[model samples]
Target: MKLASFRSSIESEIRLGIIVDDVIIDMESWGIEHDLDLPSTMLEFIDLGPAAVKAVSETLKNIDARSLVATSIPLSSAIITAPIPAPRKNIFGIGLNYTEHVAESARTLDTSKELPQQCVIFSKPPTTVIGPGDSIKHNDQVTKQMDWEGELAVIMGKKATHVSKENALDYVFGYTIINDISARDCRRSGQWIVSKGQDTFAPMGPYVITTDELTDPHNLQIITKVNGVEKQNGNTKFMLFNVNDIIEDISEVISLEAGDIIATGTPAGVGAGREPQEFMWPGDVVEITIDKLGTLKNYIVKA
Candidate 1:
C-alpha cells in the first residue's frame, strides 16, 4: 500500500493519508465520518504497526469513490509531507557502504583505506528532514560546498534487536527516496554528523510503500538528477553491504524501534567526488528516484 502524510487546503491540518492512484484518502477525517478511529499522523500509524496498515488496506479495498462520504481529494491539491515528517530520533545513515562511492571519496587522501571491513554508521538530526517539493536551505556563508546523495531509505516496522541478515527484511515497514543533501564544507575534520545533519538537508518522501509493494529492495534502479540532468545513475545491486547487513549490524548494538529511519548508502557520482568538483547553487533542483518508491524533488534557496 502507498501511504503518505499530507495537509488538506480546507482543514490545513497535517494528517495521515493513503494514496489510491490519482486521489488521496484522508484517514483522519474518514474516521470521524465512519466512526472508526484511525491514526492521524504517519508516526502514529507506523507505531500502530500491522493492525493500522490492515485497517487502511481494508478501507481501500471496500472504499468506492462513487459512493464515498470520506474526505478524498486529488493528490495535486494536497500539501505532501515527508512520510515520517518528524522522526522520533535522529535519522541513521550508512556511510561509504557502497564500494564505488567509497573508492571515489578515498581518492583525495593517502589513507590507503581498503573496503570497509565493517559497517560505517552516522546520524542526521530530525530537523534536517523535509518533504518532497520543499526548499533546501543553501546558506552561502555557512556552506558553499553543498551537494546531493540520492539514496533509498528504509523504514522500520517493528522493534528490532540482534536480528540477523536473513530476517532483517521482515522488520521493514517500507521504503522511500531520500536526497541525503550534504554540506561538504561542514565535513570539518572527519565526522559527518554536522556536515549531513544541517537543517533541510534530508529531503525525503514522495510516499512510503509498504514492504509488500516492492519485490526486491536489494535490486532496484536508483538515479539522481540535478536540474533535469542525470548525474548519478546506478543500481542498488552494487552496494557493498546491502540493506540486510545494515539492519543486522546496527541492531547488534542497539534496538531499532518502530518509526525509525535508515538511509542506505548512495552511489559514486557525488559532486565532490568529480574531478573538477561541482556544488549546488541557489535555484538549483535536485531529484532522486528509486523504482517502486516515488521521486523526491527539492529546490535550493538562500537560507
Candidate 2:
C-alpha cells in the first residue's frame, strides 16, 4: 500500500494517510470510523512496522474511497511531506552504482579513481530533505554549478546489523524517489557536505511504496526529466552493486534503523557529465520517476 504524510487545507498538523487511487484515506479518520487506535504519523507507522501496514491494508480494504474526507480535497489541497521527515541518522547515498555512471565520472575526472571493490558511501544531512513539489533552494553565492542526480531511495523497516545479502531485502520497508541535488563547485573544493547538504537539496517522495508490491526491485526503469526533456534514462538492472549488496555492506559498519534512507545511486546521465555541463538555475523543474514507485518533481529557485 502507498503511504503518505499530508495536511489538509483547513488543518495545521501533518497526518498519515493511505493512498487509495487518487484520494488519501486518513489513518486517524479510519481509526475513528472503525474504533481502532493506530499510529497517526509516517514515522510512527514506520516504528510500528508490519502491524501498522497490515492494519492500513485491512482498513483500506473495508473502507470505500468515496467515504474518505480526503476525497473532497484535491491532492494539491495538502502539502506532501517527506515520508520520514526527520530520520534518526544522516541519509546515506551510494555513488556510481551504475557502470555507465562510473565510466562517465571516471572519464570526466581522473580515470585512475575508477570502480572499487566495495560500495562508496556518503551522507546527506537530514536538514536537506524536502517533500515532492517543494522548491530546491539554489544558493548562487555559494554555488553556480548546481546539478541533479535522480536516485531510488530505500527505507529500512527494522533495525539490522551485520545483515547478509541473502536477507537484506527483508529489512526494507518501502521505496521513494530522491533527487540528489548537488553543487559541483562545492564538490570540486574537496568537501561533499556543502555540495550535498544544502536546504531543499534532497527532494524525496510522492509516496513510499511498500517492498512487497515491488516484486523485482532490480528490474525497474528509472528516468529523470529536466523541464520537459528526458535527461537520465536507465534501469536498476544495470547497477554495478545491487540493493542487497548495499544493505549488507552498510549494515556491516552501521546499524540500520527503521526510517533510515539509503539512496542506491544514480544512472549514467548527469549535468556534470554533459558537454559544457548543464547546471540547474531558477525556474528549472526536475521530475524523477521510477517504475512501480512514483514521480517526485521539484522546481529550482534562487535563494
Candidate 3:
C-alpha cells in the first residue's frame, strides 16, 4: 500500500491517507465515519503492527466507491508533508556507504584518509525534514557550501535490537526517497551533525510503500538531478553496506523503533565530488527518484 501524509488546501494539520491510483483518500476521516479503528498519523499507524496493515487493506478494499469520491480530495489540491512530520528520534544517516562516493571524498577532502571499514553513522534532528516540492533553505550566515545526497530511506515497523542481517528486512515497514541535503562548511572539524542536521536539509516522502509491494530493495535504480540535468545515476546494488547490514549493525547496540528512518546513504556524483565543484544556489530544483518507490522533488532557496 502507498501511504502519504497530507492536509487540505486551506489547513496546516497533517493527516494520514492512502493513495489510490492517482487520487488520495483521507484514511482517518473514512475510518472515523465507518467506525473502524485507525491511527491519524503515520507513525502511530505503524506502531499498531500487522493488524494495522490488515485494517488499512480491508478499509481500502471495502469502502464505498461513491462515498470515497465525494469525500476524497485531489492530491494536487492538498499540501503534502514529510511522512514522519514529527520524528520521535533523530533521523539516522550513513556516510560514504558506496565505494565510488568514498573514493570521491578521499580525493576531494583528504588523500591520506583511509577507506571506511565500519558503518559511519550520523543523525539530523526532526526539524530538518521537509516534503516534496518544498523549498530547501540555506543560511549564508551559516554555510556557503550547500550540497545534496540522494538516498534510499527505510522505515522500520517494529523495535529491533541485535537482529542479524539474514533477518533484518523483517523489521522493515516500508521504503521512501530522501535527499540528505548537507551544509558542507558547517562542520569545520569533528562529527558531521552540524553540517548535516540543518533545517530543510532532509527532503523526504511523496509516499511510503510497504515491503510487500517492493520485494527487492537491493536491486533498484537511483537517479538524482539538478535543474533537470543528471548529477547522480547509480544503483542500489553498489551499496558498500546494504540495508540489512546497516540495520543489523545499528540495532545490535541501539534499539530501532517503528517509524525510525534510516537513510541508507548516497552514491557517488554529488556536487562536492565534481570538477570545480558545483553547489546549490537559490532557484535551483533537485529531484531524487528510486525504482518503484517514487520521486521526491525539492527546490533550493535563500534564507
Candidate 4:
C-alpha cells in the first residue's frame, strides 16, 4: 500500500491515509466509520508496528475499490505532506555509496578517489525535511552552490541494534524517495550538517511503499531532473554499500528505532561533479523519481 500523511487544506490538521487509484482513503475517517483502531499520523501508525499494518490489510481485503473511492478524497484536493513530517531524530545519510558518484566527487570536490571500506555516514536534522511541492530555501548568504542528490530512503519499522546483514532487512518498514538538497559551499571541516542540514534541504515523500509491495529495492532505477532537463540517472544496483550493509553498520553503534530514516546515497551526475559546475537558482524545479517509489518534486526559492 502507498501510505501518506496529508491534510485536506493548508490550515487543516495532518492525517494519515492510504493512496489508491490516485485517491486518498482517509484512514482516520475510515477507522471511525468501521470501528477499527487506526492512527492519524504516519509516525503513530509506524510505531503501532505490524498489528496496524495487518489491520489495514485485512480491511482492504474485505472492501471493494468503489467503496474506497466513494469515501476518499481526490489526491489532487489533498495537501500531501512528508510521510513523517517530523522525525523523532535526525535522518541518517550515507555519503559516496555509489561507485560512479564517488569517482565524480573525487574529481570535482577533491575528495578521495577510492571507495571506503565501510559506510561513510552523516545526519541531516529533522528541520531539513519538507514535503513534496514545498520550496527548497535558497539563502544567498548561506550558500551560492546549491546541488541535488536523488536517493532512495529506508524507513525502519522496529528497534535494531547490532543486527547482522542477513537480518537487517527484517526490521525495515518500507521505502520512500528523498532529494538530498545540499549547499556545496557550506561544508565546514568535512562536516555536512551546515551544508545539508539547513531548513527545507531534505524534500521527501510522495508516499511510503511498504516492504511487501516493493520487494526488491536494491534493483530500482533512480533519476533526477532540474527544470525538465535530466541531470542524474542511475540505478540502485550500482550501490557499493547496499541497504543491508548500511543498516548493520549503523546498528552496531546506534540503535535504529521505528520511523528512523536512512538515505542510501545518490548516483553520479551531481552539479558539483560536472566539468563546469552547475548549481540550482531560485525558480528551478527538481524532480526525483525512483522505481516503485513515486516522484518527489520541489522548486527552489530565495529565502
Report each candidate's C-alpha RMSD, comma-separated, in the order given. Answer: 1.8, 2.0, 1.6, 1.2
Best by TM-score: 4
lDDT by residue (76-144, candidate 1, tens digit) is 988998888889998999888778788878885222358988888899999999998999999998888
Best candidate (score: lDDT): 4
- Model 1, stretches more than 4 Å misplaced? 32-35, 66-69, 109-113
Q: Model 1 Cα RMSD, Å?
A: 1.8
Q: Cα lDDT of all candidates, in order?
A: 0.86, 0.83, 0.87, 0.92
Model 1 weakest lDDT span, ten residues long: 104-113
Give lDDT for model 4.
0.92
Clashing residue pairs in candidate 3, if any?
Answer: none
Predicted structure 2, TM vs. truth: 0.94
Better of 2 and 4 by TM-score: 4
Shift in Å, residue 220, candidate 4: 0.8
Model 4 poorest 10 in a row by lDDT: 62-71
What is candidate 2's lDDT per residue for 1-303, written digit by digit as tens? 888888775367878877776667677767777777777787778888877777767766777555676333556566778777777788998887888888877766443356767998888999899988888998889999888899989999999899999999989989888888988788744557777888888989889888766746898888999998999999988888899999999999999998899988999899988887788999999999899778999999989
Off by over 4 Å in 2: 65-76, 111-113, 188-190
TM-score between candidate 4 and the true structure:
0.97
